[model samples]
Each structure stands twice: as C-alpha cells, then as structure tokens.
Target chain A: MEMSALWKLSYGMYAIGTLDGERPTGCIVNTVIQITSDNPVIAISMNKNNYTYDCIKRTGRFSVSILSEKTTQNVIAKLGFSSGRDTDKFDGDIFAWEYMDGLPVVNENSCAHITAEVITMTEMETHYVILARVQDAKVTSDYNPMTYKYYHEVIKGKAPKNAPTYQAPEKITDKETWACQICGYIYEGDLTKEPEDFVCPICKQPKSMFKKQ
Target chain B: MEMSALWKLSYGMYAIGTLDGERPTGCIVNTVIQITSDNPVIAISMNKNNYTYDCIKRTGRFSVSILSEKTTQNVIAKLGFSSGRDTDKFDGDIFAWEYMDGLPVVNENSCAHITAEVITMTEMETHYVILARVQDAKVTSDYNPMTYKYYHEVIKGKAPKNAPTYQAPEKITDKETWACQICGYIYEGDLTKEPEDFVCPICKQPKSMFKKQ
Candidate 1:
C-alpha cells in the first residue's frame, strides 16, 4: 500500500473565470476535464466554500485559462492564495483580461483559453462538480504546460485548505522556518532580521501572516 | 505566451474496481473527487465506451483503488490496455482484492481504497459522470500516489480513445513507421522485419492491427 505512486498522475493548472452580476472574478482549479467531444463539454470541481462557486451559481458561466510553465507564480498567488471576497483580485493591473460571456478571463499570457456555460452542477457535501458546455476556445501558446509535480518541486507551492487536494504541509527541519497563514508558503530562512514590512513572496501577505516556529 | 506552463495541475491515476455480476473487473480513470467530508462522498467520470462503465451500471457500485507510484506498468497493461469483454481482467491473480459494499476493491497495493454506491449519474455525450457516496473507506498505504504525468513519462503509456484527455498521436515523420490500429502505440523504426510475434504494447492486439504508413 504505497501512497507515493499516486504522485505519478498528471495535471495542469488553470484559472477559472466567472462573474457575479457585472463584476468579473475567477479562481484557480486543478481539476478540469473534457467530458464530451461534439459540442465539447467540460467539467471542473470547486470546493463549496470557495467564493467563486457562489459567483458561478449566479452567472451560470465560467472560463478556463490554461496556465503554462512560463506563467509567473503570482498567477496562483493572486487567484488561489486570497479570497476574492476581501479584495478585488484583479485590481492591481497585475493581469490583463478580456470580457467574454459577460465575465473577465485572464488574458495575461496563458497557453489556451475556454469559455463555457454551466449546464449542470451537482452538489456534493464539500464540493461542487460543475459540468459546462464549451462556448468558445482559443490557443494562446505552444510552450509545454507546467505539471503539478513541477509546481511542487520547482515553484515550491502548497495547496490551500480549500483546494480539492488539500494536504497539510510537511514539517520542515529548518531551525527557523516561517509559514504564511494565508497560502501556507514556507519561508526557510529568518525574516525578522529584515524589514518589518517583509511580505510573503507567493501571496504578498504582510509579515504578520508569517508565524515563527 | 508559453503553452508549456499549462501543465501545473494535479491529478492521480486510479484503478476503478467493480463487479460484473459476481466476477471482479476494473479499468483506469484519472478523475476522482471527494464531494463531501461528513458521510464522505466521491465522484468519478467514466467513458460510456469503456467496458467498466457498463459493469458499474449493472452492479450500481464500485471501488476506487488509488494507485501508488509503485504500481507496476503491468497492472495498467492488464486492467487498462486489455479489455474485460474478452479476457477475465481479474484472473491470473494479478491483484489482491476484497469485496466491499458488494464490489471488489484492490487491497494489495494502493494509497487508499474507497467503496461507493452510484447515487446519481449525469450522461454527457461521450462519458458519464457518476456521483456516489463513499459507503466505506480505509487507508491502504502511505506511499505517494501515481499521477497521469508520471504514467506518460515513466511508463510511456498513452491515453486510450475512451479517456477524456485522449489526443491523437502526433504523425511520425520517418517512413516505415508501424502504428497499432487498436490503441495507437507507434513504432517509429522499421517494424515490418520484426518477428511474427510482434503485438501492440498497448492493447495487446495482434500484429495484424498494425498498419504500414
């Protein structure tokens, strides 16, 4: 019964775009599969606690932006690390987007994009599996896509509690390690010696989110 | 925009266990989601064309055996490349399994085993997503799980047409390339002069399934 073998499975990162009334918003999701070919249909699993779920329920539409290896770490940091409820996720002009199906899709250098309309949503106790029909799709790049393993190994990212694959971070052996309370990014070295305003590189959270351990 | 960055999503490969009447049989699936926590529920997407789907439809129950990184390629060759319609997939004692919720579960080697009953099913054009509640669950191993990416890279396995992510193999540039007509595993070098015992590595189809192109 080896659990390590499960790591062999492949996955691609994506940003899901949806709207609440006229406000455009989106979140990160790892599970997106095409269920049909003719009139192509796709599905995405979103945690019930996510704010994007409520927005998709209201708008009945969403878009998928396929993240490439070239995508900066800030994409996941901006969309995944914080809740859209607190701040406007797209406010900083950090991402360039376009309006489609009445929603904002991150056009900031992605590999491919797809806009879909929610056809059905099945409620599970903790998550919502939203099946949708692809309305439009386009290719953005030819670079190789970044896999989840590469993200963990290269980007050194951690899954949040709201993520479908949420697992607690492994305890670090570093004598002085700090973890971001928001996104769970672990800082190996000391930060107190630096400026009091030092922020997390992944989520941009203030040093206050860091806890000495 | 680099398309290579599209790969950072996470996914795990799994052997979906089910009973064909009283006999044990199964197939491979990449999508498995935990829909609920309390009275836990799980959802899996199966292609309508796969033999495993019909078996689950008849039994109304199935077990999800989360494959670990240690899972051998032979297991996939047995359960995935070969069809249960002709051969007894569970025969030869290849996997150690037990009946749970009236369905067989692979207990020999997996991260975790979960048995569930099909509570609801939504039919898509090419596939069916069955939403089920986890009737029983148990940890089988602590090993890291096998992801789809690892399967492609390490095992050199390709997705079948029934898979949601199946993409047509890229055309070969070299002449005298022999391709498997059944599952599309291609032999780039000259294969015509090979022994008469040549068989498709993927589907185990006879050499007759090969086409000269």
Candidate 2:
C-alpha cells in the first residue's frame, strides 16, 4: 500500500478539552466528524496515550474547540507537544479560554465550541473512536475554521509524535537545519546568528531547546 | 443548542464507491476520518436511507476517491443529489472513473483512492458509523484535496439532502432567485437571460429544471 495516500485525506485542527480530576487538561486532534443531524452525534478519534482520552473515559464528557485560521501555532504547541501528566496546559497566558458545560474550551481564536457526553467508545489498536451526543454547541466567532493543510503550509507547523497523521521529519541534506527538542519543529537556517531570545515559534521553547542536525 | 455551531466542524468532499449486485454504485459523503494509523482504519457516516449504505453492508467493501479542488460541481450533483438505486451516476460523460480493488472509484480530478473492508457498523438514530480497515490505497495525483468549505464557498455548491451536514437553504429576500428542482442550488439573479440552452453549473441540468422563487 502507498502510505502517502493517507496524507491526501483532509482534516481540520481542533483542541479537545476535558477535566483531569479538578484541573483542566486537553490536547490537539485532527479528527472530528458529525455523525447525525437531529440530536446530533459526533465522533472524535483520540490516541489511547492522550491524557485527555483518559480524562474523557473517567468523566464521560469533553469539549471540542474548533480552531480558526487565526489560532496561533503556540496553542498547538502548548496543548499538543507537552504531556498533561506533569504540566498544566491551560494555565498560561498564551491563549484565552472559558468553560462551557463544565468543560474548558479555547475561545481566543476559535470559531466555535461543542460540549458532548460520551455515548460509546470503540477501541482500535492505538486509538479509540469516541462517539458522543452533542449536549451544547455555540458559535463563538466568524473566523474561518482551520484546516490541517493551513496549519502545515501556512503556519509551517509540525505534527506531534502521537498524532495519527504524524510522519517522521525527512532528512535535510541541502540546508543547515536545527530541530527543536520540544516539538520537533525544524529551523532551516543558522540558529547561532539569530538573537539570544529567539524561540521556537510552534512550541514557544527557547533556542537552547534546539539541537543542530 | 445553537445548530449553526455544528457548521464549524470541518470535512472533506469524497465519492464513496461500492458494488450493487455487479453494477458500480456510490454517493458523495463529507464524513470520512482515520480512526487508526497502523493497519489504518477509517470511519464514515452513512445515512440509513442511502442505497450505497445497503451496498456496502452487503458487499463488505468500498472505495473512497478523495476529491480535489478541480473536481467539478457536477460530480457532487450527480453522485450526491441523485439516487444511485435508479440512476447510473458514473455512466455519463460528466466524470472519469476506474475500478480499484474491484470497486469503481472516481479518478478524474481526484488526488487519491482507498479501498477497504468493513470492520464494524455502529448504528445511530439517522446514520451508521461504518468502520473499515484499509485493504489498499494509492495516490493518483498531487492536487490539493478539496475541503467541504472550498466546495461551498468557492464552487458555490450545496450539500445533498442526505448529508450529515445538510442545512436547509435560508430564505432569500429582496432579490430574484431561481432554485434548481433537482438540487437546491439557488441562482441569485434572473436565469432566463443566460442563454438558449443554459445549464445548472451544479447538476448540469437544463434550464427547465429551474423554478422561480
């Protein structure tokens, strides 16, 4: 099978939110599709390793923040690249968010948010297809929803290691490249000549987090 | 719940192909998402009323043609707006297609195609979430995949009545509009002034299919 064929499938970027006990925690995901119209039901694929997945399993509910074109790469980096087991993902001032139906949701640059209660969870090898019934939904802004294509091409962002669509970075033989240890974002040019305060745009990590390849 | 919030969920345009007793039959769908990466599995929502759903359930196999931006609106109209049970969707000169893994798939203006076998079917109120494991997949072109938004905002296409994302056309006031009887595409101006043999760009139907609103 041609594995690259899978890349042709289109998707949108989203931030899935759920509570880890008393704290807010979540991660980034690319799969979210509506399954029914009346009493709408939606499905989202979450990696078994995701902390948010464990939270949803415990709480039986979650919130989906539909990221917009204006959503920053930092939002993806903070929620996607780090583990919620130790760090607090929603504690920083990087993005604005609020609670809807008792679940935290990103609202700063998101177009809409939907809170759902889990109806069923179908297990696959590495992921779980969580089917849920929409309990509450509201449009937050008029911004256009962000497609995964826009995140890759326009924002020059890289997928997290646990993402279903994650592909290993291609070897760069033609340029002096620096790979960010935090989020795997690559710097194509000389990192030493840049300012001391330069940080990885995707994950907001300092230059010290980059390693020359 | 604000139903408009559901519109923020993003999706891709696709043509699903399957066999109806030895004849090729399929329809257009917007919900297709990868559920697992290894030995890739995908989930697609099919309305219970669709003929193709019965075909897939019986045949236990199907194909997905990832439509590109260049795919004409007529493809959506023929395969989506019409019923495959009574009409030959791929028999005309509207679009080019070929059989892959014994199932017909649209090749013209498509980026890739994937053939799969059904693994499970989870029933919902109005739809079934069919999970399938990939049998074979191949990239046919390098064109950008078409997102549902592009089909609506750029091609000016309307969703089929059976689609999970189907929304009733908002009443147009203060303008002369003509609606297609077969498909709900509305022409914002007078259709009588176009030509002697004007056709609806969406379904390619003749001027006779239009009705004044």
- Compare the candidates by TM-score and give the number of the best one: 2
Pairing residues by index, what is the TM-score of model 2?
0.80
Q: Residue A97 lDDT in model 2?
A: 90
Worst 10 residues of 1 chain A by lDDT: A1-10
CA displacement after TM-score superposition, residue A193 of candidate 2 (Å): 16
Q: Across residues A1-213, which tens digit of lDDT does each residue of candidate 2 receive? A: 998888888899999999999899999999999999999999999999998899999999999999987776657877899888877999857578988989999976899999999999999999999999999999999987888887886555454544443333233447898878888666777999999999876567899999996
| Candidate 1 lDDT over residue span A1-213, tens digit each | 223332333456789988766677788887787666677777788998899999999888888887766665556777888787775776765557777656677776677777889999988777888999888777777644656655675555444444433332233443577767787666667778869888776577899988875
DockQ of 1: 0.26
lDDT of 1: 0.71
For model 1, the stretches where C-alpha displacement exceeds 4 angstroms are A1-12, A96-102, A107-109, A142-213, B1-10, B93-102, B107-109, B157-213
Estimate candidate 2's alpha-carbon lDDT, on a 0 to 1 scale.
Answer: 0.85
What pairs collide in candidate 2? Answer: none
